[model samples]
Target chain A: EAGVAQSPRYKIIEKRQSVAFWCNPISGHATLYWYQQILGQGPKLLIQFQNNGVVDDSQLPKDRFSAERLKGVDSTLKIQPAKLEDSAVYLCASSLGGTTVRETQYFGPGTRLLVL
Target chain B: DQQVKQNSPSLSVQEGRISILNCDYTNSMFDYFLWYKKYPAEGPTFLISISSIKDKNEDGRFTVFLNKSAKHLSLHIVPSQPGDSAVYFCAASDITSNTGKLIFGQGTTLQVKP
Candidate 1:
C-alpha cells in the first residue's frame, strides 16, 4: 500500500514571502495532520483535519498560517509573511479515521522550508 | 510546558550490541505511547508501541517498555545494526481525545558503528 504523499520536498523563500505545502493522505484514510519540525526538535503538530473538517489547530499561527482539507483526501498548509524562524521541515501524516484513537499514523517525506 | 522529553540527545553503540533509548512524560493522561525512527531527510516511521496497561511490548528485535508509575518508557533494539542508526522519537497520546493527536519528544539520535 502506498503511504502518504507530499509535494515539493524542499522549498526556499525570503522573509515576509509566502509558501505553501500540499499533502495527499493514504488511500481510504480519513484523517490528516500537518506538523513542523525544527532542526533538533521533534515534529510539532500544527493542525489536524478529519474528513474536510478541522479537528484541532490550536498550535497554528492564526496570523500567518492556514490550512484546509476540502475533499477530505488531500490538504494544503500555507504560511504568509514567513519569518526566519519558520524555517523547518513540514511533515504530513494520515491515519484511519475511526473511534479507535490508537491507530498508527503514516507519514510523508515532508517539505523542508527555509526562509532567508 | 514540555510534556514529553528525551534527556539524551545522542547515543553510540557497537553493532551486535544493545541500543536503549529512554523517554519521560509529565502527563498522567497519556495512555498510549509510540516510538518512531527517522532517518536524515526523511519522515519518521512507526516502530513499536506500548499501552499504559501493558509494561512491555516486543516486535522482532525492537521492544518497548512502559513504566506508568514513573511516567517513563524505553525502547530497546537488540543486536543493533548500522541500519538502526537514526533519530528516535517517543510520542504519547490520550486516547480519550478521540482525535489521535500525538505529543512528541525532542528525539534521541542513535549511532550504531559497524
Candidate 2:
C-alpha cells in the first residue's frame, strides 16, 4: 500500500499572499489531518476530516485559513493573506479511524512553507 | 495548554549504546502514546508505541516504557546506530475512548556517532 501523499515539497510565498497545500490520504483511510510545525516546536493540529465531514478545526484561524475535503479522499488547506508567522512546515496524516487502538496513522512528506 | 513536552532539545551518543528519549504529559485523559521519527523535509514516521495500561512494549531493538503514575514515557533504542539519528517526537492521543486528537511534544534531536 502506498503512503499518504502531499504536493509541493516546498513553498515560498510573500506576506499577504495566498498559498495552498494538497494532501491525498492512504487508500481506505477515513480520517485525515493537517498540522503545522514551527521551528523548535511540536506540531500543532490545524484541522481534521473524517470522510467528507469536518471532525475538528477549532485551532485553525478562520480569518485566514480554510480547508476542504470534498470527496473525502483528498484534501486541500489554503491560507489567504499569509503572515510571516505562518512560515512553517505543513504535514498531512491519515488513519483508519474507529474504536480501536490498532488504528495507526501514516504521514506524508510535508510541504515546507516559508512566507517571506 | 502545552500538554506534552520533551525537555531535551538534543542528545548525542556513540554507536552501540542505548539511546533513551524521554517525554512528559500533563493530561490524564491520554490513553495512547506514540513515538515518531522525522528526517529533514519529511513528515514523521511511526515508531514504537505503548498504551496507558501497559508499562512496557518492545519491538525489535526499540522499546517504549510508560509510567502512568508519573505521566511520563520513554523510548529506548538499543545498540543505537548512525541511522537512528533523527528528530524523535512523542505524541499522546485519546484513541478508542474520547477525542482522537494527538498532542505532540517538541522533538528531540538525536545524533549517533559512528
Candidate 3:
C-alpha cells in the first residue's frame, strides 16, 4: 500500500511572501492532519481534517495560516506573509478512521520550508 | 505547558547492545501511547504502541514499557543495529477525543555504532 504523499520536499521563500504545501493522503484514509516541526522539537499539530470537514484547528495561526480538504482525499496548507519564525518542516499525516484512536497514522516525506 | 517531554536529547549505544529511550507525560487523560522512528529527511514512522491498560508491549526487537502511575514510558531496542539509529518520538492521545489527535515529545536521537 502506498503511503501519504507530499510535494516540494523543500521550499525557500522570503519573509512576508506566501507559500503553499500540498498533501495527498493514503487511499481510503478518512482523516488527515498537518503539523509543523521546528528544529529540536517534535511535530506540532496545526490542523486536522476528518473527510471534508475540519475536526480541529485551535493551534493554527488564523491570521497567517489556512488549510482545506475539499474532496476529503487531498488537502492543502497555505501560509501567507510568512515570517522567519515559520521556517520549519511541514508534515502531513493520515489515518484510516476518524472515530477510533487505535488507528495508526502514516506520514509523508514533509515539506521543509525556510523563510529568509 | 509542555505535556510530553524527552529529557535526553541524544543517546549512543554499541551495535548488538540495548538502546533505551525514555519519555514522560503530564496529562493523565492520555490513554494511548505510541513510539515513532524518523530518519534525517523523512517523516516519522510508527514503531510500537501500548495502551494505558497494558504495562508492556513488544514487537520483534522493539519493546515499549508504560508506567501509568508515574506517567512515564520507555522504548527498548534489543541487539540494536545501525539501522535503528534515528530520532524516536513518543506520542500520546486521549481516546475520548475520537479525533485521533496526538501530542508528541521533543524526541530522542539514538546513535548505534557498528
Q: What tens-digit string does per-residue lDDT give for candidate 2 at A8-74?
A: 8999999999999999999899999999999999888999888999888989999999999999899
> What's the CA error at residue A57 for candidate 2, in Å?
0.6
Q: What is the alpha-carbon interface RMSD for each candidate? A: 0.7, 1.7, 0.7
Residue B53, model 1, lDDT: 86
* Tens-digit lDDT track of model 1 for A1-116: 88889989999999999999999999999989999999888899999998999999989999999999998899999999899999999999999988787899989999999999
Best by lDDT: 3
Candidate 3 lDDT over residue span B1-114, tens digit each: 889999999999999999999999999999999999999999999999999999999999999999999999999999899999999999999857767789999999999999
Provide DockQ values for all models, in the order shown.
0.87, 0.69, 0.88
lDDT at position A64, candidate 3 = 99
Report the backbone clash tally of model 2. Answer: 0
Tens digits of per-residue lDDT for model 1, B1-114 = 889999999999999999999999999999999999999878899998888889999999999999999999999999899999999999999857768899999999999999
lDDT of each: 0.94, 0.92, 0.95
Better of 1 and 2 by TM-score: 1
Query: Please, what is the TM-score per model?
Result: 0.98, 0.96, 0.98
- Candidate 2 vs. truth: CA RMSD? 1.4
Query: Can you tell me which runs of candidate 2 are displaced by over 4 Å?
Result: B95-97
